[model samples]
Target chain A: MNIRELILNPDNFFKDLSSKESSLTTPFLIVLALSVLNSIYTYYETSIIFNLFPPDMQSKMSIIMIFSIVSSFIGGFISWLLIAGVMHLISMAFKGEGPFKRTLGFIGYGFLPNLIGSLITILVGYYFLSNAQVPTLTMEQLQNPTVAEEVISSIIPKTMVYTNLLINIAVILWNLGLWTYGIKYARDLELKKAFIVALIPVVLFLIYQIYGVIKML
Target chain B: MKKLLIFILFLFFLLLINPINAVEFTGIDYKNEYLEPGKTYDLWVIITPEKEINNTVIGVSPYGVGSEYIQIIKGRDYEGNLLQSEKGVGHFIIHIKEDAPSKDYNILAYCNYTKDGKKYSDNRIFEIPIRGKPTLTVENPSVINEGINRIYIKIKNKGTGIAQNIKIKFEEGNNIYALSEGYIKYLKPGKTGTVEIKVYGENSGIAKLPYTLTYSNPYNDLQLVDKRETESRKSKTITYNYKNQKTVEESGNLIFKIIPNDAIDLNVKDCSFPVGKVNNFTLSIKNNYKDSKFTVIIGKYYIGNNQKTLSINYGEIKNITFNIKVEEMGVKEIPVRIIFGGNEIERNISVNIIGKVDLVLTGVNVEGITEKTITGDLSNIGTDKAKSVLISVKKTERVIPLRPYENYFIGTLNPDDYGSFELHAKVINETDSIPIVIQYRDENNNLIKIEKNISIKNLINPNQSQENNDYIPLIIGILFIVGVLFLLYWNFFKKNKKIIIKNNKNNREV
Candidate 1:
């Protein structure tokens, strides 16, 4: 709050952030590769596989499902680039040479957030496509074959509500872990140091997400 | 160099890759111009595939657009198995119900080509519209009888295709004739031809005119119909007949001319050319046939002096001049007579002949034997000379000599200009050769003027035969011209419109 309190605090915060950056580097890369591959596969499935059911079947879904898929891709790609830029700034603060190459390795591990986010989103995209109802009465699939109620229920159910809630809540947790790992990974910070800085967005996002859930409810 | 080569390779690859999905096949297009319901229409199917292929198959299911609900009963593929699963690539035909709904339908082309006796499905969608069949058109028609009723029944095809087995029948009230009896014909699109039907009075109760057309369009599998009726009121014929009447002639060659006053109607056959009030009538023959009957309206003219009955001839000459002589010394105006049958016209002329006298006075006035007197006369001797007729005044020296022919009284003295005058003269009795002339003198005979030279036929013993005479007609004629000018001024001012002087009315000039 005072000049010394504001200035001395961020220096201590960055010193603690650098100590944990060294510890999350190896584990962050492992998880990032996993999440990336997960997002790539689901991206193909939602773009190609979901649209394959014919336009009449696909047309009736709400834009929330459309936005989530699009934003998931956009947020995934943008998050990778933004996290890398932030890591390069951290490397410049450290006076490290080879900024571009080192910055690549530094926050390339930031894909972990989107990867973890997709693992959760895929479960929801799967549920929505399979359970969404057809808009019109299907004659061939009905009376002659006598399509069962269970079949209709299984084909198109309202899964977007529950899936959206679960994924959004998981995203806040995933993003906090990613930013914390990113700050420390560039500066080579310890778990105890990085964990201290991780509380900032953890508190902010929790407040934001709670407000969103309340409005929707 | 290697990097540039790699960049060029990448650019070429991008161009080739775009060919597979080049055009965006937005949707299928169909119009009623070709296929509308039971009517025919053309459907255009364009597909923008996911990727390019050598050839793409298109299928049209004409119910509406969507997952086509056409029944695919279990059938054998080229491999001859139960064809539930789709083959590699092939085509199919589906029959639409006659009562199919008219709307948009989706066509799915399931290409069936066997790969290891299995079927795969690759489909594209196009919309086909189902509409009603074409409707028939029957036009209101007309029949015209120009040079005998030429009944033109034209069944022109206005539809897209040829109307098959075309037929037209005409029904006039209770009577009807199939077009096959030479009363009907067909016309191709945009052309017209005639059909002639010669008809006689059939039963007298029906109208003699044929008018109507029933057109039919037998399209695809549907039968749609419409009707038209011709309007009424026929045109009738009008005939004309004429009659000729008698013509009355207007007299005189020039319209405003002096015709003989006693002319009457010269009738030839039955008509008369009215030569109104004329003695010399020129008869013109005209043949007028009214109701095909000819007649000479007026016969040729007749002259009493020429011929009694001259036949009617337009260019015939009959010179008819007449003269009748009488013995008289007095001034007599004699007339020549012309008669057309009972019609008589008398033309007058003066035939003055003296029988027992040498002279006669027309204007002579003398009370006693005086010198200043003269007389006018018209004479005829036939053989002998006239007497020395003179006025020997017993107290004066005046002598007036007379000529032996008709003479009007000139002034006793001669004038330089010729005009009417009046004066007095005396006759001189002379037995020998003597100058006998009537002279007018202003007292002393200084300017003596002779009125006439007289020849002495006999030396007379008469003491005096003189008279003072004057021609009073010359004074009366001068007064008549002045009277006419005064009457002209009176008539002009009396009949003319009067003008009021608006300005300076107080100043009047008398």
Candidate 2:
């Protein structure tokens, strides 16, 4: 039930969850608290991103960023429910045994390592934010593809972006590893079947993220 | 069969009744087949007798309608006799009315002659095609370059027929003179023939050269006969302005005024010199034309030679170097005159002469030793003024330059003006000469510096005085170092002892 046990001892942490009955509301609140912290970091980073725009556009982007933050918060809770429900259903198909509520609670606890990673990312992002030279970007420059490339290249250092990407990948990999054990303990399935069930949600989430990135480009 | 025999008997009776004539008109020849309206033309008709018949007369009628579009001019020889030759030919001058229609007309040629005591008259009629007139246009007016002009004339036959034998005669005027005539042989319908005429303009103004263009369309295609009509147009006016025309064409007989490649070249061998110094400049005058004499007059100035006039021959170059004295500083331009043949060009020679500055150090007074203040008077002994004068003693290997003895600032000093300065230096070895540097500006406001060495006149042993003054800052610096170390110990170590004692009390209470 404790967040410290979930982080330091994740294997025994999931084993304990398999033996006892837990309430989904408490685990859901814990995940929500971590999501709020991540959203606050997102707000600050988005504000720093808006600073690169011209004065006229920065005012307009402030309104858009507020809308985006509200949508992301709602979207995050829906995604957690969706992934938990999907994992419960997959476990049932594999002839495993577990309550739906327990699977959902274990899925929430599985997000602990990812929350720690998000906290570290916010700290590292602050270091980059202080050293970054905000480019003078205008609405006209953003509309032009060539000028947008120049503005982005000037503001974001390539090495820092690639390093941040690698860190995020490592953090996701760590979260996926924890979720595999969480699924195995909750579903009472083989390790291989638990990994396949865990991998399905993460891979689908990665595909959705890649699709969003391609749409932006 | 009986009807066929009757038809043959009738053809035989008609052939038997037909009589053979002694004289016959075999061929008919006309001067021109195509005629133009409103013009006179000549038509020669050839008449042939059976055996050299006498008293032969030839007549020609070129008309189809009731209108008189054609008329005969001459049908007899110079002796007032009919045309009597092997093939008796008649020369007739025909004129087409101005309002004649453009269509085909019939030309009737009749010949009456006496051949071997029998009179015979023969007549022949042929179709003569009447066409519209030829149009003459001046393609390009006379373009005068240098002194020659080329006039272009074009003739186009806009009529239904062709135009033959085009002759153009260009008339000359006051400013224009014709060099050659323009002529074109033939120009078909919707076709043009271009010709160029060479003309000469004697003066620089508008030249009006009237030209007469004469071309005749053939009334008859065969034979050498033509309409021989003359059509004259108005004169073409061409302006010959030399100032506006700077580009000279390469082709044609162009007479251009020859000058130097560089009109008036003024070269200063040495452009930089001292003020009030005499400098020499090379003035080169070249005449590119032959049989021309040049007279050049120079302006008044301070020169080595009083002769201001110089004469140069044609195609010859004259380089004159005159020494001139510039009285003031800064950049200056000298006026020069270049007159060659009938052409004159005014030019200027630029020179930069700088002013010279001289600073003299006099009346050195040395008062003290160890902390020595050397005083002297600096006077502007040159011909120019000095500004922002400052004096300082440079540091050397043995002697050290000291502070609290600042550089003296003397503002602007005119010619023969003087300013005094006081300097301080610590002399480790009295044998060394103190370098006194004085920085100032010349008449041109340029920053310059002058250095002078003044020998130490009065020397004294001050080793004990330097040793006594050195202990003051050394003792103060050591006392300041001891106070900073005590503050660091009280801030860090004293605060740590209080925290350790508080933690021990808390552990005992637990």
Candidate 3:
């Protein structure tokens, strides 16, 4: 459910794609739908960002929540289609027994994993949000000099930040795996050549994520 | 649903890249919601039970304050009507105007929460105190003349909050060796309380003497504490040299002739007063020469709006009086004093000059029917006490007549319990008298007479005729007639009426 692992394993992403047949659209649509639902629930939890600027700048996480859920949902779908379809197209243009049927089957069944992911995320986040108590920040507590830092450092662990960093790296390696697999499943490339190509997407995404976490830090 | 999805998608994109906002609470605290005179505190709203609770749900939480001074600075239900704003991390900055009444306030947050799409907005209570400048009063602290003993200290809270962990000591004269030992507890707003310190020797003789006191309220949760000091205390001492025959322990007691003797402590040393134009006059003495050697300096003083003081030679004899001249009009209060080492003795004596006064002793002669003439003579003093005058005369047995220096002429007299004759003129403006100036012409060609003034009790008009001789007979005749009428009615008329009534009643019954 944490999408973090999914982003990190390029070989598994394609291996997932290989076992089932799915169009770029179905799993993307499911992810988008789940994301929308998540956003509505987030808004319910955080209300809206009302006082953004000017005199009072009190914004609810609801605004950010809605935006993140929606944009990420759409972007995920788009990215899924562009990468999968282009690789499929590249495979079709090349030689021998381009088994579109089996490939589509592999992709289609692979959608199940993300659907489970979305469902899990939605359920966990929703249940938590619904039952969550809005913690009151005592004016004194807020003004206490060390409480904020103590709370932040204590809650968000270094592993999470580092893992997120790794996820970006994994994004590139996964693309490389898929692209190399295009040659293997559709063009029937030799195992050695396909294995060499599988590592590219994870590397690029890794570089990008390095920039990301640095900026974040 | 599609639009909602798009909105969600858009949000997801932004979150994937956007930075979290910082929550700045610009002094809207009642006390900062801390209840300041002009500033306000924000009511931070956030997701409940969120590990990082920096989010506030709009239109949900109910905020209320217990104080009348709580006003929403901006961005609340209305622009300026009790405004509460979204400060990131669940804090809102509210603005309150100056001149609001200080009080305890409440902000209740109310909102509906939906887990699995179920919604409810419940209320929670938050307390804020809006306080004015805390009233400061320095109370007389309980002092053990021991370590850090405070002769005077204050309990002070300059703000509305309870001042906690207040520690203070007499900054200059604290007997305590270290400050950590001097700890005074909390104080409330505008409240007064005492702090006892035994930082000094509680059993020492110095404990009885007033000392400089100072203190501070470190925590604003209590009342303001003021410092105490002996320097501002009022005192006087009366010291004197007894006949030198009295014991040191029995150095005669003193009485403030005008004021109560026990009203305050007095130190007596060598002091003096000025009489007439002469400069030196004895006022007090200092004779404390038993256990320790001490010196006394006599001084002259002038009292009024502008008081003046001058001291005599140190270690001088106890009975020495100093000389000093002053130029002033009307009533003058001159405080004569003696300062021995640190001991002081002072007394205020008053004198007046340059005013108008007159006096008379009156009696009348009956033969002439004229108002009486005053035959007594009186001298001239200042006008101040002259009007409240008294005069006395005694009949002489040998008639050793008047002389200029007989020392008996009348004059204004200062109150004297030990000196001379008595007569009081307290009630009225004037008293009338008749004096029989008795004269006797003996067989020889000589005249003997004595004059004595007798008071006239009545001032009513005197009638020409004496009517008692004429009215007595008339009154006697009227009395005789009334008696005869009473005798006739009782003996004849009453008896006749009784018999007639009896006869008539007997006939009617038959």
On DockQ, the leading prediction is 2
Q: Which stretches of candidate 1 lie over 4 Å from their true place?
A: A1-74, A84-106, A113-117, A136-182, A188-193, A196-217, B1-510
- Total colliding residue pairs, candidate 3: 138
Q: Score candidate 2 by lDDT.
A: 0.62
Fnat measured on candidate 2: 0.00
lDDT: the better of candidates 2 and 3 = 2
lDDT of 1 by residue, A38-92 (tens): 5454564455334323346666433535655556545554655655565455445
Interface RMSD in Å per candidate, to 1 decimal? 78.0, 27.7, 64.8
- Model 1's chain B yields a TM-score of 0.20
Question: On residues B289-381, what C-alpha lDDT tens digit does candidate 3 reach at each position?
Answer: 222233333233322222223333333333433454444334555554433334333545554422322222332212111221223333323
Tell me the lDDT of model 1 at B327: 31
lDDT by residue (tens digit), candidate 2, B339-381: 5556554456677767666788889865333445677788877
Ranking by lDDT: 2, 3, 1
**TM-score, B chain, candidate 3?**
0.27
Q: DockQ of candidate 3?
A: 0.00
- Angstrom error of the Cα, residue B292, model 3: value is 12
